[model samples]
Target: MALLTVKNLKKNYDGSPVIRGIDFSINKGTCVALLGPNGAGKTTTLRMLSGLIRSNGGSISFEGLDYQTDIRYHIGYLPQHPVFHSWMSGKEFLVYVARLANLDKKTAASRADELLARVGIADAKNKRIGKYSGGMKQRLGIAQAMIHQPKLLMLDEPVSALDPIGRREVLTLMEELKQETTLLFSTHILNDAEEVSDELLMMHNGEIVESGPMEKVREKHRVDKINVVLQEGFIPDEDLITALPSVIRTEVARGVHHIFVTDTKQARDELLQLIQAERWPLERFEVGRASLEDLFMKVVDS
Candidate 1:
């Protein structure tokens, strides 16, 4: 059964609509990603779902709960910029939020300790949040969100604000969290979504352009392309590859070449033959499915 469902969800500010009518659903124990560029209403949709804001139209249902009633108790939300009481220790902050979520004092304290350990911040639990780094803060935010064990956890651009190490830390935590509950997060980073999500919800111009299981969505809008990575200082002959009957288009960047082809099998055979004949040093050659980034661009451009 779907953990959450939405129909014709619409939101507006002033006289302009920020979210056009859209429909989507989430199932239990799945990690779903809401993907889009800036100002694409990713935050707005997440806000509405989190009950931080009211939708101007449409219905949002959580496990058969009526949309007209409060469903906030069934969800946990971490905004794009999660605010913290700088003076409060990490454990203190989580316990506070847990109490606000209606847990008793003892349960809240226990939950806070448990989550601190789960998010890999137990050692720093006594330290003031002001002293925590970006990655630590994000991990704490995630911990607080899961404190009440809400059926669905919603995060808006959760890992977008961190350095590489910080990003990796939160992503690794997210992978573990998804095993415990349903997760829905918004991000413009295709690689992050591709890495963790079971499904994807793509937005453009405030509407969901496409959404489904990650692989299914990619296949639906699949573009045939081969990615060739050459050894250092080696470059593919762009003109020669494009001249082939099976090749459609070519894109080169750094030391990699992306060749769009009509037939993957034929293209692979021909490209390998060309490379061998020319004795070019090849690092990697991959053909078939378009990457998440490539598929995302195609959806946006369409």
Candidate 2:
């Protein structure tokens, strides 16, 4: 059975709709990425899902029951920018949130340390929230969300404030979390989503533009892209390159021709052999697949 389901959900801030009739479902033991460009309603959807904000229309069900009442207890939310009591230490803050989540005093303290360590902030547990940097706070946010051991965890731009190194750390933690909890995350970072999520929901202007399993989505958007750097002054086979059944288009830029294939894969090796046999001074030849970023651009553009 699906662990969470959103059906015909609609929400508006003031009179403007941010989430317009959104609908989707997530199963247990699965990670689903809510993806979109800025102002694409990703955060709004997450907010409604977590019950931080109620939807003006439709329903959200969790474990096959109305989530607004029952499932609220089963969710953990890491907001894009977590508000903190600057006066409180990191450890204290987590304990407070943990207590508010209904954890017992002893378990709350224990959960606090576990989560702090889980997000790599154990040593800084006593540091005041105001002293922490953006990345540090994001880590704390994640810890607080997970300490309660909620069934469906939602993170909005969880790793956005981190540098590349910090991003990797958080992504790795997220990967580990998936072993035990269902994850629904929203982020502008395409690579982060690509790394941890099994599925993606691409949103635009209050609507889901596309949604599917990660590999399936990539394959759906997959087009062949290959780069060939020729031997200096080696005349290239423009007509022959385009004639390949899989080649959607070919372009020569800065002495390198990029071949985009969309059909048969038979002659890719033969084409290289032909080029090498001619000894065209090929310095580089490599195949490239469409990345989520590539797919994101194409989908949002259309």
* TM-score on alpha carbons, each prediction: 0.87, 0.90
Q: Give the TM-score of candidate 2.
A: 0.90
- Model 1 backbone overlap count: 0
Model 2 spans with C-alpha error above 4 angstroms: 64-69, 224-226, 231-235, 243-249, 260-262, 281-288
> What lDDT score belongs to each candidate, Candidate 1 first?
0.91, 0.85
lDDT of 2 by residue, 160-272 (tens): 87888888888888999999999999988798788899999999999998898999988877766788887778777688777766677888888878787754355477567
TM-score, candidate 1, is 0.87
Per residue, candidate 1 scores C-alpha lDDT tens digits across 1-302 of 89888999999999799999999999999999999988999999999988789999998888867647568777889999988999999999999999998999999999999999999999999999999988888889999899999999998899999999899989998999899999999999999999999999999999999899998987877667888998888665678888888999998888778888998889999999888888889889987776888777887888
